[model samples]
Target: MSVLEIRDLHASVQVSEDELKPILHGVDLTIRSGETHAIMGPNGSGKSTTAYAIAGHPKYKITSGSVTLDGEDVLSMSVDARARAGLFLAMQYPVEVPGVSVANFLRTAKTAIDGEAPKLRTWVKELRTSMEKLGMDPAFAERNVNEGFSGGEKKRHEIVQLELLKPKMAILDETDSGLDIDALREVSQGINRVKDAGSTGLVVITHYTRILRYVQPDFVHVFVAGRIVEEGGKELAEDLEASGYERFVNKVGA
Candidate 1:
């Protein structure tokens, strides 16, 4: 099984050419294949910062600490290299690639990750099946990447990539943000399908526990002020949903 380990990861966001704003402070996390981890916190809690930093976003620089995927130095790899290493990030806002069709983008990404082109007939069938499973229309394959798509459609498309690429580990940043109830259920099912495959460890970052109801996390981490202050099982998410992060925030500020 694959393993991802984050050790005392401290990172800062580049505010200007010469300025860096620290976000994560000594964050540590570990996830194995077949496990789902949820990082929950209030706004500005460094949750997404952790995701982006681990995924090697240019704006977020790691000041100290190491991130390893299956014992390989993740921080040392380029963004594309990180992806080629079986790491995937479903951004909070998927960008719009106006000229590229969805089919082309997925196939190109899969080819890059696998280092080989998939057979055309097999690829076409798999792509259609994945889109249908995500409740997406077959016509979406012909549309430009996320161009003119609704919020729900964008999120569903990201999950479609997650399914098609089958990365070793995926970091989903606020995937539930713009989804309605029906859309949320469909997206969650897509996630669960990947989880059920018994590979592709998942790290879900969210402000609410709504998504957890469908994609239960094996571990729940309470992130506050750039650090994880509390950790527990699924029940911790329920408590946070009920009690809120007031106490945790107050404690961090205290």
Candidate 2:
């Protein structure tokens, strides 16, 4: 079984020549394969910061701490290298690639992650199947990635990659953000499909408890001021929904 260990991870974003904005402050987390971890927090609590830092986005700098995938150093790896090593991030805002078709993008990403090209016939079939399962029109595959797509469509396409790429761990940043009710269910099912396969560890970062209803996370973490202040099971989510984050927010500010 694969394990991802984040120990005292402190990271910052370099916003200016002489200024570095601290985001993740001594965060520690550990998630294993087959485990679903939900990170719920108020905005600016460093939820997405943790996700981007883990994914090795150039904007975030890891000053002190360690991230390991089964004892292998993760912070040392380049962004693409991190991906090649089984880490995937479904961004809060998936970028629009104006020139790259979704079919080409998926295949190229798959090749990069797998170290070889997939046979066109089999790959096409797989891609078509994934798109259909995500409720995407087949023509969407021929269009430029995320361009001219609705917010919900972009989110759904991200899940299509998740289903096809099959990474060791996936960090989803607010995947439910712009999804409508039906789209929410569809995306949640796509996530559950990956989770049920027992291959990819899940770190679902969100601000609300709605997605948790369909995803059924095994652990819930309440992040505040860049640190996890509370950890519990599904009940914690229900509590947060009913009571909100005022208690935890006040504690963090106190």
Candidate 3:
């Protein structure tokens, strides 16, 4: 199994005219294939920042430390390069593209990642199957990419993309937000399908333990003040739900 490693990761975001506000401070974690790691924290604790930094977003600059995917420097790769190299980021708020249909967007992504367009006949079958797995309507494929989609619909669409794209590593930022109970179960099942593949490593960033109940994590990390303050097994999530992040926040002096 391959591992994605983050060593002493320190990142900053540009704020003022010439000032940078430090966000992540020395975040270190390793995720191996076939394992799910949950990053749980409060609002403004820099959980999203870590996801963006790992995906090489220009808004967050890595001042020190390294992010490596099986010994390759992920920081050196362009966004598209990172995607093609098997890194996937499912955004908290998926954006809208008015003109591009979901089918076209997904096919284009598959072509780019696989270095060749998949067969139209078989690709359609695969696409429909993926959509069905996510409990999405067959009509969703005809809609514009995330255009006017409800919160649950948008998230389910992302999960469909995740299933079809099949990236080696997935970073899901707040996937549970805005999901109804049914949608949450559907989305969690879709994620578990991907996890069942046994070749992808997953980092699920969430604020609550509800989602963890469906998509169990191998490791539960308590993130406070831009860093992981504590880590343990699935029971940690239960404890957090009962105790809340107050102790962790206080310990970090955040």
Candidate 4:
């Protein structure tokens, strides 16, 4: 069974005068348990829009089609409800919340999604362990969320949340950007750890091939003009790497 399914999904963002316009057009995708899928495209291809739409971001309107989580209707649920239903999005640009400490944010989010507070002892221990696994300093937990964090640090924080929440399906929206070699390796290791826990699915959106070397996707999809136009195994990513997305852009009529 598919853990996440997006069938003929169409979404758009509103703007003055002529609406900003549809971003995703008839995108059909299915991610099963323990599978990792990569969507690669150039700028303005709607990869990030697909992630935000699935997570119920208010900016993206579901103009048509449907999204389901384990056969449950996701479009009918609120954003918070979507998170609670085992859907997680590690954003391309993680926003900073100045007043909230990382530890507090994780705890509150976990409690809200889990419908109960996590056991204090186990939660802290596991959180610390996960932090160490990501090569983050223990003191990071005390800092304000994403405040003063470098790009790599913010990306690592997203991985920290992924570890703590252990969502059934994680949509990583360009989590690879802005990382140095070492940091990318750490972040990729964190993702691998999450996959090792079992029954988890990953949808990783990236423009570069560096991160793919570590995480290794089961499928590669090419998005252009707000629609997926090509898909294949991992080699598709290598092909894009060798030849670039120009071929895909032409093929998709973008």
Candidate 4, after superposition: displacement of residue 221 in Å? 0.5
Worst 10 residues of 2 by lDDT: 129-138
Instruction: Please write out the lDDT profile of model 3 over residues 129-223, one tens digit for every residue.
Output: 98887888889999999998999999999999899999989999999999999999999999999999989999999999999999999999988
TM-score for predicted model 2 compared with the true structure: 0.98
Tens digit per residue, CA lDDT, model 2, 1-254: 89999999999988998899998889999999999999999989999999999998888899999999989999889889999999999989999999999999999999999999999999999989888888899799999999999999999999999999999999999999999999999999999999999989999999999999999989999999889999999899999999999999999889
Best by TM-score: 1
Candidate models: Cα lDDT each = 0.97, 0.94, 0.93, 0.92
List where candidate 1 sits over 4 angstroms from the true fold. Answer: none
Candidate 2 structure lDDT: 0.94
Cα lDDT of model 1 by residue, 56-154, tens digit: 889999999999999999999999999999999999999999999999999999999999999999999999999999999979999999999999999
TM-score of each: 0.99, 0.98, 0.98, 0.96
Q: Write the per-residue lDDT of candidate 4 for residues 112-178, one digit (tens) a residue.
A: 9889999999999988998888889979999999999999999999999998998889999999999
Model 3 ranges off by over 4 Å: none
Error of 2 at 52 (Å): 0.5
